[model samples]
Target: MSDAILSPDQTARALPYSALAQEIATLLQDPTVAVPPRIVQALQGGGSLFVMPAADAQVAITKLISFIPGNAERGLPTIQGDIVVFDVQTGQRVALLDGPTVTARRTAAVSLLAAQQLAPRRDGPMLIVGAGVQGRSHLEAFHQGLGVQEVWVASRSRASADALVAHAHSMGLQARRVDEPNAALADCPLVVSTTPAQQVVLTARPRSDAFVAAVGAFTPRMVEWSAEVCQHLARTGTLVVDTRDADHEAGDLLQAGLDVSTLPSLADVVGQTVAWQNAHRPADGPVFFKSCGWGGWDLAAARCLERTRAQQG
Candidate 1:
């Protein structure tokens, strides 16, 4: 059989946010999925080559992406590559999927799953800090998965913010571009930060019932929220990480001096007893889910694509 090379749009359609989130939730509870630590090769001028690999019972996938920070000025995406998935039993290549789309959608799906399990309010106003690919995908995820109706987009470039707002409007959501994301924090129950994490983008404290996801800053050197704000949330709310790897890569939590070992990871939530959840989770505080990238999510996306193909055939 010829290997399928899926365009970004095709890849995205196969792994819808709702279906992708459900796949991730299952993999989180399934112990057989093996996601090893990703390897990073340093490049000249602050670029990086990332090789992320993962496998489960049926499939194995490796994602190759080049992170060229200078690409922004060159009018190119900083991350570019594709995920190559193969059948584990036959050792044959099955599909090649766009990496950026997989990354954006799966990351948003991680946040979507966390929001479903933790957020006190799902269908309320949401604030997206950094209106880029991530912001756009997340707007679709929350809107489709959790029924978010209103959205506010913020970015350093007014044009970028407006683009995301317009994209949201195109999706039939009530959307607006905002100058200050923090100013709207009090009114939004959902907040997601997807900036480059060069500096802090949001400083204000979120409401007690809010569900805020801090994504896009994966390395120790990158940070999105002020240390004070992170610490405030840590002290006053529940902190859950997307995976165990966040203990090392979650700069937002690490820079705030919070011990990541004590936090509940997404993997811990799916199969736990109600008593375990009640004992570990806070009764009345915000939920701060720090999402660093994970290869396991990519594996889940591959599984979703495989299932989509099977259903179609």
Candidate 2:
């Protein structure tokens, strides 16, 4: 029999941001789960394909996705593919999920998880950069996970920025379009940078309480923050990464010449209680959360899907 397939909407409905972030938090502490390095192949014209696989005792999953930065210009989804989930013991295919949706949601959930533990203050306006799929996902994740009430949208395309702003307003939050994202950094305590990393979009130094999550540039060649901005954060604030893989893949940190090996990762913080996290923060500077792609995060999505399926049945 063919494996079941879930459309993007169905898959999204299965993995709510709060639940997804909680799942990721759980997996971070589960040493039994195994996540090997993903294989990335370069495609022509600057695009790339990713093959990621992860497994626990009960379920296994492999995701095949391609990212083409030029798709935005052509009015196409930049990310495309599917994730195949399987039963570990039976070796039978369980289901397939829309890869782009999973990627966007899980990546944002990782940022949400970061914000929950790292943000000095939670209730405030948020700033979103890169008005694309990631931008939309981050907006929803923050709204759902952080109770954000207001937002600022910044992007290279005015139309795209305006559309995201409208979407935010539809969600009943105060929203605006900012041509320069850095200018609004002082007031927005939370910021998510989702640009394609072709160039630096945020240059100005953020306020002391800012919690900035930069998920745009996974490869070393791509970058969204200027060197000075990264250095300032590294010197004065706590620098955390989603995973240790960021030691090599985080363009902003690597380009800024910070030692990724010494940085604290999300896993490091996930083990602590929420109150402990809030109380133990550095309290000196902004918190910079660098997220490079990781297969373990995909595993968390699969686990959530499996749980959702079990609950429905």
Candidate 3:
């Protein structure tokens, strides 16, 4: 069989947010799914490289990503990489997928899953912080997965924020640029932050019963939320994390000084080990989710994309 190469556009087309989120939920529960710890290697000069590998019964996937902070100044995406999918039984490469696209879609799906499980369903404005790739994907996720019609985008760059709003409008979503970050947080019931800023970008007090998904700031040294958000989680709602390893890499959780073991993992909810569906949360509190990027999601999304391409062919 000939190996297929999937471009970023193809990759994005293959996985609709709602379907992708459903597949991810099933993958998380499948006992056959296996993910090894991601390997991070420092480059000789400046940036870093990450290799994530995962496998199930039928296929395996490996995603290689290079992080170059200086790429932004060069007008290039900071993340550059690809995902390779292999047929486990034949040990042959079956397809190649765009890495950053997989990352953005899967990450947003995971965040949507967490939000659905932890927070109550309501109709209100959804807030997206950061106008990067992840931010754009998450806007689609909330809109597709939860039927969020109203959206607010917050970014340090006015142009970037406006661009995101335009994209949202193209998708038939009611989106607007939020100049006041604080006001956006307070008004939106669903908030997702995809910025990579080291300092706190959101200082506003979120409304009680809001759902907050922090997608960026994966490293222990980087943070996105102020201490106020942390304190709110500690006092009122449950803090859900993608994996326990996030305790080491998620600065949002680490800096908040929360007990890692005490927090519930998203896997438990997906696996139905916890009574997540019927679980009652505080009526006037916030449910927070912090993702540290999982390798298993990469493999599952790659497999899904391959299936999609095959059907299209």
C-alpha lDDT values of all predictions:
0.89, 0.90, 0.82
By TM-score rank, best first, the candidates go 1, 2, 3
Q: Least accurate stretch of 10 residues (summed lDDT) in model 2?
A: 273-282
Which ten-residue region of model 1 has the weakest summed lDDT? 273-282
TM-scores of the candidates are: 0.96, 0.96, 0.93
RMSD of 2: 2.4
Across residues 1-313, which tens digit of lDDT does each residue of candidate 2 receive?
A: 2367999999999999999999999999998899888888999999999999999988899999999999988989889999999889889998999999999999999999999988997887899989999999999999999999899999999999999999999999999999988899988889999999998888999889999999999998899999999998877887888887888889998999988877778988887645335533565789989999798898899899888777888
Extract clashing residue pairs from model 2.
none
Using TM-score as the measure, the top candidate is 1
Best by lDDT: 2
Clashes of each: 0, 0, 1
lDDT of 3 by residue, 1-313 (tens): 3587989998889888877788788888788988988898878765779999999998899999997766766899989999999989899998898988888899999998887776665466888899888889898888888888988998988988999999999999888998887777778888889886568988776777688888878878779988767877768876777887787888877887866666667887777666454444556678788898889888779767766777778
Candidate 1 lDDT by residue in tens digits, 1-313: 3489999889989999999999999898777899999998999899889999999988999999998867877989988999999999899999999999999999999999999988988867899998888988899999999999999988998999999988888889999988888898998999999998888878899999999989978988789999999989888888888888999989988988988877878877766745337534567889899999899999999999988998998
